[model samples]
Target chain A: MTEKNCREEIIFAGFGGQGVILLGKLMATAAMKAGYEVTYIPSYGAEVRGGTANCSVIIDNEPIASPLVTEPDTLIVMNQASFDKFVPKIKPRGLLVMNTSLIETPPDRDDIEVMGVAADEIAHQLKSPRSANMIALGVYLKKRGLLTPQQVAESLPYVLAKRHHDMLDVNTRALMHGG
Target chain B: MSEKILITGNEALAEAAIRAGLEAYFGYPITPQNEITEYMARRMPEEGRVFVQSESELAAINMVFGGAATGKRVMTSSSSPGISLMQEGISYLSGAELPAVVVNIMRGGPGLGNIAPSQSDYFQATRGGGHGDYRTIVLAPSTVQEMADLMFPAFDLADLYRIVVMVLGDGVLGQMMEPVLLEKKQTHRKLPAKDWALTGCAGRSQNIVKSLDLVVPRLEKRNLMLQEKYRRIEENEVMCEGHLLEDAEIVLVAYGIASRVVRTVVSRARKEQIKAGWIRPVTLWPFPSRQIAAAAERARLFLTVELSYGQMFDDVRIAVAGKAPVHFTGRAGGAIPTVEAVLDEVKKLMQPGKVAVER
Candidate 1:
């Protein structure tokens, strides 16, 4: 009872087609299923196809206030551009999850814990390049221990469209493998 | 208990409208609000309701006017520029005493501006955007859950008063997703009959609905009747929420997404022993002025935070009536105010001998 309920603010950023928004949505759905108050807001603009896309997600035991995350507790970047843009904004000693295959250089910060996962390489090995985001998500969940693999697996149908249900098995494998 | 699902604010509004037994949805696609039209297009036809993506915003609003004239639950949604374009038809609906709901997922304004969240439309939405003397019931939803919950009451209020109602939100609220337990389709609530509907005059006398009157006295009488109805609305339906106001020294007045930011500020300020409170106006038109006045009696100062350049600050000043010093902090042209920026403003306001006067 002495421990206050923790609030986790996360930002997922990548190229538009990298499924960054969907990754945030999946995390938000899983968080909601786990009985936490959650909010997900995606970066929207006219150049959504090839442009950079990001989303902020807040999962708290208490009711969430603002959906905008100015400084995030976790930074998940799939590309170098996103890393450069958002790495400075992470809270000190925060968790930084990056796609090592894309960002060759690591951040210079000594305070934060940086977890570099070869997400794209793993997805390529699995023959499912689109599942890179799932791999990254799996890494974040494992590091944070906010949600279990089973919880995310169960919430897949809620976030994924019906036509893409066939990919759930690969997504789950990628998630568990990354974890 | 109903099942909870993650839904964006725009999608929540569309789903709630369908559950509220919406008969028709007519709207053109616009940024931040296009999701509503897309959702309605997908679901309305499946549910055997009429859904149309009109050629333009002007045509869409007229379609709402036509559908509402037949006493059907009709609605249309848009962003700031699109809503501005629909003002003429909105005026007609208000003058004709037709019941309709218009959802404005407001974006940066004046012109096409940008497709970003903004509350700059405060004056436009609350003070009557269209011509002539008229008032529309404005409901400002701060959460995705409220985005769904308010639609039922919005449609109900419109029908009860025989006037147009607006659900005012911004792009941030429209795009953000949260868990919500949507109420079941409203079948139990009693709805007043649309006896003035322009149905065929088969067994009864013809019912004519028109806003134009050639005579001056008749127009004046219509204006006076509308004013009386607005007064009744103000008396019965002023809704707001006061948070941490019991022992507060500073009260922050905000609505919609800005209110959400203010809530965070209040919490952070409390930890630092700053007795900051917040008042969120749920209904912007009726404007819960009494609540603000009461808070002024207890609080030493008042502040207003908005996504616009002090648009809602005027209303806050009016409510405080110079009883307490009122300050304003805001961002316009599609920028959102950060927590640090707002907290800095609050800290400055708490400084000694720096008072704010009404603008």
Candidate 2:
């Protein structure tokens, strides 16, 4: 409704092939479908390995800039490496989400809002370890008040393409659980 | 043209390609550049255009090669290291004189560089990233609007020269957003059809499209033809934007995102009563030498700003052709220069008696 509907910067960082980039993209695509401008940029180079693969996604009611989020409003660190690499860069009063199973260090800083979700354990409980990224997304959405479960659910088809019809229910359920 | 809409540089380039009548896209995910591929992946199918999320950057460029061979509008994109992987395919495309567009949203380099805005690829892009005595028509867009506007001209240049066209930019340009007017779509331009296209030979002689001209003499002749084409491009396609150059004593030469920062510095300098201007080269190749030389004839000094260790400084020197003093100022590995930093250099350049920092 304003010049900038919701200018939110999010960083997704995890191990290689943890679907961190995919999850970031899902959020960006959903925000874009909600008539927002979105930019998604994935990690490049050796950082894609055990170091830490990260992607930056910006969703704004207005145009975005510099997808490399120097100071993200939301920081989702799925692994220890990511937490170590990105936690200090989170903006004051920004939202920080972590996979409790992987990240041992809690948010030591007082300026940021931190949420720890046993995303891996939840996914395992849901009988899909790969859906941890989705669980993390769900928590992020709930905590930030950026989108609803339905908007995220509506975005699954766009993100997953032809495979969506099969995994749609699971992902939506995951979002519902966290949302 | 449509009403102006704010979009990121990658989205602007994608829209420009669509306006240029791009028929096919094949790209792999890479940092500081995935949005271009993502945009094509989702939009192409809806437009009845072909889009492939190729297994790797290598595969994507080869797919571009296949599409270009058919005289179809085709494009591929990647970042620095991924573009490194695409070099073999690009060399083949260049050798075969195929028309295609390549977008490089560069990050830091020299081996899996971190995913931040960096211009370390200036040498790679300008020196022909691939092997062989070939070149790509490299157009560097400084803003989101130019990202949209330049692609059409790039595609046209590639088609006219029958060579690969590259949009050389970095994460700053790729990820930054600004207002851009989407150009109206027109029918694909009329050009000589490719007889060597692999579309089949039902009732005609077989046509072979190969860069492998094994015969030395034949290869020599082909290389000479390409050399002549590159010369023609240099002569005809030189483009650069000069700002506040009238009666300016000092000139800042820059391109892409760096140029935007310099533009700000120039405006601020004017307010400070300093006669400083800027030369923003839109085409990295065809180096805009004539424009720089023309500016050098009257300007007191030239300052080259970039995101690398002064790669464009070499070109600036060549453009100045030793007539005016040229100085280099830059930062590398995702480091962005501020207007204040550029202004500092401009102030020193105007002094004419300060120690020139050489790296």
Candidate 3:
């Protein structure tokens, strides 16, 4: 058999307001800046508030043909619902980035790599739990060389906007400190 | 290359359009597709690009028609029902041979259907839902990156063929989060001078752009020319993806969300040593009939998974051409089938003589 290619499909899922989409964007932008073709797709239910939100990102050196990641190499579950809905789809030897403050039970698979981070707690320590998304993004960057701190920081203004400029800086710091 | 950012399919498309240097976006609001409009509404005005939330889809598509006629890069998007409303305008755009991009985030249908993702618009998109004989360049995006990446190609095709190009996506595909490399914006392609384009001729003769050819011979010739354009599109624009099909006994044919779900199911089935492969069509209009036909000769059973009841299945049957048994499994009205549901169907369709460890 030919050597299996090592491309990463990362999924970030959580409840509304957890900034699931923002984290996915940060990862995609960082990966793209790293010279990898990236695709980011966000999925949400009907409910605008408190609804389930999940985003999938695929980073590869070759030209990525499809952006929809059916099978993920890593899963970052921030809520119970997010974990329950997508846990089964995680591939073998995949990474699990879970929010210990939210998801209590770890996944059942023993072959996979599991990392539980108290994102909310860390964010609270930073006086901004919402930056938990940024914390999770930092971990992703550390584990997978998808992006650099500088590249991700460049896209901060476009993502965080003027209203959240201070928050953006804080989140960037959180990423740096956490990763 | 720019840094990576996680983005919604809608936001990805919006940013991609900005990157692609799209000049105008005319659209209205609809579920599972609101982000596409919202992204434009928030960015277009600030970018000095045109963005209009028209009262209705019809007005929005017609506005796109006007903008495209001026050789400006234009786009408009809506959901299934709203897309139905825009069909008349689409037919006109096709008839006038104008170039533009139309995105349809499919949902439960026939009328004002539910907001959940559905592929009911497959037939409407592939078989010319609009009146008269016309074919739009239909691109089915299964991932958020493809959703963003295809914009440049979709726009280029529209400009190249002088026809309406469409990005057909279901709610799940549109709403899903995935990483996408937004290519840097390119310089806008200048439209070649068309004698018929409605440019005020600036010291030359007058120009008129219209589809109404009252003369029968002239109308017939125009339609014949359109038929030629469609033939070229079908011949050259076929795009698809094939996975683990060599030496497989069964091939699962699907697209968009269904294809994504089937891909996972195939992986799980392989763990049990059940060999199942898949053929995913990226361009729905130029259906991957050639790929399906080639695979059918080696595969015994053709299983089709879709959100709607037996729509894309028909295409599978036609492509397989009785070389194998074609089976279909679907759930409508926004019901997302689990991997178990798909695996169960796949096992049921395994040939009678074939043996496997019962789950």
Highest DockQ against the true fold, candidate? 1
After superposition, the stretches of candidate 1 with alpha carbons farther than 4 Å from their true spots are A1-3, B185-190, B353-359
DockQ-better candidate, 1 vs 3: 1
TM-score (0 to 1) for chain B of model 3: 0.94
RMSD of each: 1.7, 7.0, 5.7
Clashing pairs in 2: none
Mark the regions of model 3 whose C-alpha exceeds 4 Å error after superposition: A1-45, A48-162, A165-179, B19-21, B42-48, B184-193, B351-359
Regions of candidate 2 where Cα sits further than 4 Å from its true position: A1-179, B185-190, B355-359
Considering every candidate listed, which one attains the maximal lDDT?
1
**Tens-digit per-residue lDDT, A2-92, candidate 2:** 3544588889999987778678767876776677766666655446455668888878886442344678998998999889889998999
Question: Tens-digit lDDT track for model 1 on B1-359?
Answer: 58899999999999999998799999999999989999999999999999999999999999999999999999999999999999999999999999999999999977999999999999999998999999999999999999998998899998999989999999999999999898854634577899999888899998999999999999999999999999999998898999999999999889999999999999999998899999999999988989999999999998899999998788888888989988899998899998889998888888778665543
DockQ-better candidate, 1 vs 2: 1
Give the lowest summed-lDDT range of ten residues in model 1 chain B.
B183-192
Tell me the fnat of candidate 3: 0.36
Query: What TM-score do all the candidates reach, one by one?
Result: 0.97, 0.69, 0.76
Between the candidate structures 2 and 3, which one is better when assessed by DockQ?
3
Give the distance in Å from residue B157's predicted Cα in candidate 3 to where it truly belongs: 2.0
* lDDT tens per residue, model 3, B85-107: 99999999988999889999998
Task: Assess each prediction's global lDDT (C-alpha) against the native.
Answer: 0.91, 0.83, 0.81
Model 3 chain B lowest lDDT segment of ten:
B350-359
lDDT of 2 by residue, B6-125 (tens): 466889899789878899999999878888988998889989999999998888999999999887889998999998899999899999888999999989867986888888898888
